[model samples]
Structures are given as C-alpha cells and as structure tokens.
Target: MDFPKLNLPPVALRTRMGDRGRTMVWDVLRRRYVTLTAEEWVRQHFVHYLLEACGYPAGLLANEMAVEVGGVRRRCDTVLFAREAARPRLIVEYKAPQVPITQEVFNQIQSYNSVLKVDYLIVSNGLQHYCCRMDYAAQQVTFLRGIPRFEELI
Candidate 1:
C-alpha cells in the first residue's frame, strides 16, 4: 500500500482476511486486525508518518487508547508522551480522507482534553492535518498548519 511520508521509522504490516469480505491488517503496536475502514486506513498510515517523518519516538506513542468522559468510554486515535512531563503531551484524532477537518473534530478532541488535558491536540484525515497547542490557564488554543517535529516538543 502507498503511504504518505511520516516522521518515524518503518513498521512491519501484514494483510489477512477479515469478516464480511473485509480485509484485515495487523497494527503492530495495537496488535489487532483493525477493520479497513477509511478512517482506520488513514490512521494507520499517519501513525507511521508521525514516527518516520516527524521523528517522534515510537516508544512514546500510543494508538487506539481509551479514555472516559461523562461516565462513558471514548477512544483516542493517538497519544504522544513526553518523558520530561511524565504524561501525554499530545492527543490526536484522525478522520477518513473524505471527512473534512471541521469544528466538530476540534470539539471532539476538546472534550477528550477535558479529561486527558494534554498540552497539544492534533486532528488529521491523511490528506490534511491540524495541530494546536493548548493553553489551559489562559483558556486558549493556537492552531498550526502541521504537526510539530519531535524536537519542537522539547
């Protein structure tokens, strides 16, 4: 499969048959046959991109991580941790290529932030990506055209 450039290293992926005539693939870290949903496809690719092209340490990244909000369960696409902070430094929400990067996506991450309270937020659809730094004390967010490099996090 053709994938976009990422910031991290290459990962081994294998294809296998899935239910309902779907093709499943193994996501190494997640260790599961994730359904080939459009969004999932974008997500899988971006995870590699973040590591191969963005220089994000693979050990510091988490995929398909779960969190709770308002007594309900929710999943975050990716969570990046910084060693110095001893917690998640960024939370990412990924959409299908067809899904537009809109306020709804931002709002979803914001809701997650209410609980996780990460310092940065990233939303992407494989095609376009939006990143921002959160300033909780000031109640503000600053948008960036793309995800910052690994060094920038420091």
Candidate 2:
C-alpha cells in the first residue's frame, strides 16, 4: 500500500503485511503494531514530525490516549504530556489526506479539549496542518504560525 506524501517531513516507518492482507505499521509511542489506515498513516507522520523535527521527546508522547468525556470514552489520536508533571499539555487530531481540515474538525478536538483541558490543540490531514494555542485565562484561541517546538510548548 502506498501512503500519500504528507506535508510533514518524511519519516521512516516499519511496515509489514498483516493477517488477511492488511497493512500494519509499528507504533513507536505505543510500542506495538497497529493497522495502517489512512488516518493512522497521517498520525504516524505527524508523530515523527514532532519527534524528529520539533524535538519532542518520545517518552512524553502518547498515541491513542483514552479520555472520559460526557460519560463516554474517547480516544485522542495523540497527546503530549508535560515531563515534570506528567499532565497533558497538548492534543492532536489526525485525518485522512483526503479529509479537509474544517471547523467541524476543530470542533471535534475542542470537544476532546473539554475533557483534557489542554493548552495546545493540533489538527492535521497529512496534506495540511493547523495548530492553535488556547489561552483559557484570556478566553482566546490563537492560531499559531506553525507547529511549535517542544520548548515553545512549555
């Protein structure tokens, strides 16, 4: 299976054919092999971008993180945690390369934010990316010029 070229820096991923001719890729953050869907393809690229280009520590990044929202369990695509406090600092949502990044996409992340209450939010469709810094104190959302480095997040 050929994955679409993402806007993010190219990343090397370990992939293999799984049962029933399914494609699978190794998830370093999860320490397991997961089915390589289109969204997962974008997710893997974004995670590598944060690790290799943005200087985010692998230890602090969690994929498929579960959070309880409105009495239901929802899994966040990726979550960045503070090293010192081990608290969630950022949430990332991924979509297929063909899926347009729209306000509906942002609203999905925002719903997850209501539970995580993270300071940063990111949405990506492999072809395009968006990052926002939420200033709860000021009740404002600032769209960042670009994806921030690990230090900038702190």
Candidate 3:
C-alpha cells in the first residue's frame, strides 16, 4: 500500500511483510507488532506526530480503548488522557487514506464522546483532518485549523 503524506508530521516507521504476505508495523507505544493495514498506517503516523512533533507523553495516550456504544461494546481508535488518568481530554478517530470522512464518521466518534465527554474530537483519514473543540456546557462545537499541541489541552 502506498501511504500518502498526511497533515501530520513525517514518521519513520518499522514495517515488514509477515507470513502469507501480511504486512506488520511496529507499534512503539504498544511495544509490539501489529497488522499494517491502510488505516493502521495513518494511525501510526498520527501517533508519531503526537509524540514527536506535538509533545504528547506516550504514557498519556491509549490506543483502541474499549467503550460501550448503544449497549454494544466498541473500541475507540485513540484517546488522550488528562493528568487524572481516568478523564479523557481528547478522542481521535482514524480511517483509511482512501476513505472519505463523512457525517457517519463524526457520529460514531460523537457516540464515543457521549460516554467520554472529551473536550476535543479529531477525525482523520490521512487525506483530510477535522479537529473540533467541544463546549459541552454550552452545547457547542467549534472546528479548528488543525490538531492542537498536547500542551494546549493542558
């Protein structure tokens, strides 16, 4: 798969083809190798951008955390935690580079937000990125130019 340059910073990744030509990518955060699909490629790049370019501590990030949506268990792509550890500050949802970011995608993350109550939401497909600052108390959401730095959330 040809991975395109995204809005995020360049990332140096370690990837290899596995048995039956299954591509695998090294997950520095998880400290393991995972299947390298199109979406995963975007995810890895975003992770590196958060850690290297934006200064988000690896300890404060979680990948594929499980949540309940409409009584159905689902996994969120990534979440940035507040210092409290339990409180999530941001939720990131990623799609394959070729996938179009639609309202359904936003709705899916919003469902996760219904449970997380995060202050920020990001949806990306490597080709495009949408960042939103949520004012839950005011029942409003404002789109941003790009993802904010880790310190900005703090």
Candidate 4:
C-alpha cells in the first residue's frame, strides 16, 4: 500500500511488519495491532492528535465500537463518550487521505449519529478535517473552526 503523507501533524508510531506481509500499527484505543492501510494510517494519526495535541481524555476515546444502524450492526471508527458508555459525546469517521470528504461521507456520519445523537461529529481524511456542533433543540449543526479542547467540552 502506498501510504501517502497527509497534511496532519506527524506523530511517532510503533509499528511492526505483520506475518501476512503488511505493516501494522499499534492502536492504543483498541489495544491491538491493525494492518496499516491508508485509512488506518489516517485513523492512527488523528487519534494520536486527539490524545497528544487536543488533550482529549484517553478514557473517553474508543476505536471500532459496535453500533446498530438500519437494522444492521456497524462499527464506528472512533467515538468519544461523555460520562456514560451508551452516550457518545463525539463521533468520528475517517477516510484515506486520497478519499475526498464529500456529502456522502458527511451523510454517513450523520446516519451513525442518528443512533448516537452525539453533540459533536468529525470527519477526516488526515489531510483535511471537519467538525460540527449539534444542537438538538434547534435542530441544527454548527460547523466548528476546530476540534474543541477537552476542557471546552466539559
């Protein structure tokens, strides 16, 4: 796989070539090594950014959490929980750096958020990132300038 360098800040990673002849990166949230594909590369970068730069609480972040949508089971790429396991504070979906973040991507995240009803949503492709703040009362989503700090969320 041609892992392109994205616009996101660089973070040092622990990696190993897997037995299957693929590179793997350590997923701190999931506590395992996953094949370092294009999307996975972006995921690892953004997740690490959330932890090291944004100061997001590690305990609140999870990777590949089970979610039920449209009578089928799906796993969200990453989620930030508030004080409860069922309620997510933020839902994030990642794409490969080459994949453009389009309406379809936004709609996909929205669909996932339908069940989550999270306060915030993020869509990223490593090179670019978008965030929105949800107002259920107003039935509106306000685009944010950037990901809010953990303190700001609290």
- The best candidate in terms of lDDT: 2
lDDT of 1 by residue, 28-55 (tens): 5677788777777777777877777888
Could you estimate the TM-score for every candidate?
Answer: 0.85, 0.97, 0.94, 0.95
Question: What Cα-based lDDT does every candidate model obtain?
Answer: 0.81, 0.93, 0.90, 0.90
Ten residues in sequence with the least summed lDDT for candidate 4: 81-90
**Model 2 segments more than 4 A misplaced:** none
lDDT measured at residue 26 in model 2 versus the true structure, 0 to 100: 99
**Candidate 2 residues 109-129, lDDT tens each?**
999999889999999999989
Report the lDDT tens digits of candidate 3 across residue range 81-121: 89866789999999998899999999999999999999999
Lowest summed lDDT over 10 consecutive residues: which window, candidate 2? 1-10
Off by over 4 Å in 1: 1-13
Candidate that scores best on TM-score: 2
How many clashing pairs per prediction, in order?
12, 0, 0, 0
